[model samples]
Target: MKWTRDSYRWIALAAGFTIILVGYAMRNTFSVFYPVIVSDFGWTRGSTALMYSLTLLVYGLFAPVAGGLADRFQPRYVLAMGGVVVGSGIALCSTPTSVWHFYIIYGIIVAVGTSLIGITPVISVVSHWFGSNRGGLVFGVLGAGFGVSLVTAPMYQWLIATYGWRSAYLMIGLCAIAIIAPVSLLFIRRSPHHIELLRQKDTDTGGSGTTPGLSGRTEEWTVRRAFRTRSFKLFLLIGFCNMGFAQQVTIAHQVYFLQDVGYAPMVAASMFGVFGVAFASGNLSSPLSDRYGRVPFVIAGCLSTAGSVLLLRITPNPDSAIIPLLFAFASGWGLGVVPPACFAAMVDRFHGRNYGSIHGTMILFISLGGAVGPWLGGQLHDISGSYFSVFTLVQAFLIVAAVLIVFATRPASMRITS
Candidate 1:
């Protein structure tokens, strides 16, 4: 198929959406895998959960390096290579005999692979296809991939039940390799500039479809300059507190938490699926942030998410299904809004040729927060004998997140480039 400048952006979007959906699914499956790993090994929740913390830490630390690579090289090669690494690492997981083996294999290897193919690089590539005018909308569409990945929770549970965790992981790894590699290589491009350059050779219109690059109008934002700005610092805080810490606390333990309270494993997984669907719904709604404003949506999302935890805390009957359904939908929708809006707001302020590096650095702080959350939740549970303290902490961080965004998105902060 001949790639027109107009048509190729959609193609890139679709490819990115697919890659993110599959890649994040691999990460999200950890929730379902959490209990099984614990049951099989009889490890303490805190120690067993530490592996996940290590994974987030490694992925966070490596994100800047991945983004730098995406900026300097062809994204196709970078993403395809990441797919291979992710697949290999997950497949190798079937062979680990000790907990430390997981720390090495899943924590370091798979984490690095995920960083390579994760939101940082994918957002960098997609940003090239559309200008900041559509950043929220396009990013919402892309962010939906993360939510949709969660929708596969039931399927993952079925795999674990039917095939056993080891075999299920091997199958998932193979699928990741098969799906991510070709789509990335065949469809992802360096930027619209390459497509426009080809279009210019074919006609005199000079590729009018291409969105203007940020560097043309704004002062170039190097990684160092972005770090110096107050907005960037606030963004880092929002990412760490809300996006990383509160979010990971839920993602890593929601299913297990539900099971501990009363719901059966499969039922808990289904509730997670409901959460995923609602999350996708919120992501689709994020385009409104582009119209109304990013900060309001973020603050609303944070409050809504925190409120959902209260529903979980007050669940009159986990057996009835209504409360879990409400909690899942409300929390998912609320959690979904902040990420695309926050990142879009960042793009509104900081996007440029060096944005990949800047975004990667932002993700690093988020990862650090993420690294703490799961382990902390597990430790809190270990000490308190319930998720009560864990849920309370989530609400506290989310509220703090909402307050921080108010400062992060201030008009004075938005105007600063250095």
Candidate 2:
């Protein structure tokens, strides 16, 4: 069967989804490995988590550069190199005998590799293929890849249990290299124009279909001009508070918290999978925000996520299965809902030639939060001897995030006419 213009968009979307799934899975597998590594090396939780923090830090720092590279060059080549680098990083992780070795391999190397193939660049590519009409749904589905990657948590646990962490890392790394490099090189294109899928000039709508400006005149936005606006600044805070702090803190430490509260390791891993399932559901649901408006979903997602932390704090029950299930689903859905809606909103406003760079910078802020969150969660746990303070801080951040979303999405604030 030959690929047509109509079919190629879906192909590109699938390729993007696969890249995100495999790349993010490599990063997330660290959660499953956390306890095992600690057990093997006798490192303090705070010290052990610092490696994860370093990855986020590096990922955040490099995101804009990755975005800029994707914007200026053939994204396939960039993504293909990312596949090789990330795979090598993961594979090399198996050989680390010391903390510094692991830090260099997983923290800096893997971080840079994944940043190349991550949401910033992938979304930049997809934005060119898709327009505003279906942008919400498209981004939602694309973002779902991240959530679905989490479903592999249980599998990672099994791999570690059966073959050991080293072999598991090696196999996963090999698979990433074999799969992502080929798929990205073959199927992913920088834009629809590369494939000869040309729409009418009026329908071009840039990458994301429509500009947020009511003028209907498409204008290009440089990073500096975008920075001068309040929306971009608000989004930076949103990314930091929501993606960086809340997400990183939760992802890095949720398994440990569950295990600490009397749940077995396997059980905690399973619960992590539950969160992934719910996260995909919430992620996929963001399309509704296109119709109803982005603010509601963003606010609701923030509140729901905040409430889940509160739920876990008040009702710590390892004996009953319900609490874990409820916490996982609620938190996952709430967390999942925010990003696509937020991304869609960003694209609605800022999609242009330089969107990749703008989006990458946003991820950098998120990475900064991510860099701090896991380490902070670990240190807080070490200091308090419980997650009580950590949960409180998460709730506070979520509330602030909710407030930021309202102001960020306000109609009066977004008057960026060309």
Candidate 3:
């Protein structure tokens, strides 16, 4: 065999896409069950929301471990095992008779599974595939999972309505096992090295394929080094501010906010669907960063997100219909560009032997912000009986996040090699 372009790249992309879609579809569907779980278990909204916060915490905490495992072992086994755990956890969640059971199954177990199979593994594999044109298109395709969930959520809702929530869980769990196992076994390769071997006739004829001067250089910073860098510190701050705001609005209160203003349950759910549409569309803008630049799009996305939050705050009831759609578009674009842009910047600044480790550490910080946002939003709502304070706070954070992005862009003397 000879190393060829067509041999394994497309196979890897297809498998990667399937894994992402399934993982996110399961993760996002949790919101659809939030109300039902609360009603059935007679738990307070705050209690139910606390589970989400805990889930995020666990997911974040487990990410680096999962990333390290993927770096050391085959992703196929990790993904297959993750699918089994998540599927079983969700199935158990459906049958739980107590709130603690819900927490154990949904919050801990399912979250662990999600963390293992989610962004870290998928992005790591994709990163190994393309270098120059990697950031925009890869993230854009991965972000499309947000849109896919719009379809999955409603379908799940219908299943719950017709067959009951327990049945819906069982169905989805089976689907997860069916999809993830074969895809991982058939398509996932450890690295470009594996792909190169599959395409080459002889080992001696094949080079490592890494860039020449970039190979075997270990000045690459560890997680500690990344923390010490001015750029990394600024990136962490930006992540905290932006994610704190976005998670609150999008995850914690968007549905309730719509219902309070005037929309019915069905209509409110559809509004989330619209938000998904905007999210998917924004992903399309990510690839453009390769052409223009990362920082510019980050600035644009931040401003757009802030403007949308402002619009949501002031819109009257009659105008609320238009607001959800607008907010979705703004948020979609913002989210679409941010991850890839930020990750690419990190790689550019700190391309070391431990890229997975460093990036995973940063994500853990962002996940902490994610945990705080929703829990805080729910607590404030419980106290104030309105989301007014929460939305205002979100706007403030977005502005601050924009400033952090600008600040993080200052030229740095540090560079990492292989």
Candidate 4:
């Protein structure tokens, strides 16, 4: 069976989008359970936070393995297995009777599921199908899954409210299997080669039958080669620092911080919706890097994220309209630029052959930062009794991230050019 060129593009996009949606939906469902799980289980705040941290740690650690698997085997199979694991884990979560149960199900199983179906594999697939100009746009559009959870989270919350948390987990698990499994089996193909007739049609029409502007040069640096490069080291440092700040200030603490600043629980949750919107908006800006260069967008985003941290620190009240506006702008700007720039740069530097393995390794550092951020935030809040210390620390991290980005852009250093 072969697909037409147009059909191939659409199928690839759909596959990419499906992976994003399922992974993000599973990841964000945790927030809806936070309050309820703590109350019912009598877990300490730190203990509950640890579960999420562990999830991040595992997801990050396993990403490289997942990527390697995708590289070695079929992406569709990897994704299908991921759906099964994640759906089962979430369903099992409905029956947890102890903290370790949450740890094993949510922290370990679901984390493995996420790594398999999440951005690491999706990005690798997308990189195979698109070139420089369209790549950033494609990545941005697909990456919008991270934001999709904003809408899904509330829906999950409503489901939990209507039923019980246990029922909610079961339902979400069912949804994951129903949605992702079929999509993976029916639509996902490893590459354009899967569609022979489509290739002929494209070649007949004078199309290259490959991504436009792609050199088709498969010179890929292995994980060892990538690590030996100065650019890779700098990227790891930048990713660690930037993700640490973003995860701590936005993903982990924003809800609690909003509550501390006098907003109701519902309001705090709504603010996450706004954050999602900002996140999507920021992603939209990535393609612009194709025209203006990745350096400017990367620098601007890092600086803006730093500025947002400062705004939160200095604001008299986070509930104030001005604070939300500033936070949204900064966060959106940062989130959008970092992913596409970082991804494109790596591919450009290393080329496509080893993209999965190299990028997967980089994501491990990003995941490590994400794992530490929330745990550190919870610890700091427990010690200081306020978000001020955490915000200050985030600001410092962002500043360091910005400095690393500048260092990354220097001439005479290895940089990726599409």
Comparison by TM-score, 2 against 3, better one: 2
Q: Against the true structure, whose TM-score is highest? A: 1
Better of 3 and 4 by TM-score: 3
Which lDDT tens digits does candidate 2 get at residues 275-321?
99888888899999889888898889899999988778765677887
Name the lDDT value of residue 383 in candidate 3.
84
Q: Give the 10-residue window scoring lowest on summed lDDT in candidate 1.
A: 209-218
lDDT of 1: 0.88
Query: Model 1, which residues run further than 4 Å from truth?
Result: 194-218, 414-418
lDDT of 4 by residue, 110-211 (tens): 999988888887777766666545666776777666665555655765777789999999989878978777787777775653233234435644865454
Q: Give the TM-score of candidate 4.
A: 0.87
lDDT of 1 by residue, 207-304 (tens): 56433452254456778887777888999999998889998988899999888888888999999999999998888889999999999999989999
lDDT of 4: 0.73
lDDT digits (tens) for residues 104-213 of candidate 3 = 88889988988777777766666666653566776667766645555466677678788988899888987887888788777777565434533342332367644354
What are the RMSD figures for all models against the true structure?
4.6, 4.3, 4.5, 5.7
Candidate 3 residue runs with Cα over 4 Å from true position: 1-3, 193-219, 315-320, 413-418
Q: What TM-score, computed on C-alpha atoms, does each candidate reach? A: 0.93, 0.92, 0.88, 0.87
> How many backbone clashes does every candidate have?
0, 2, 2, 1
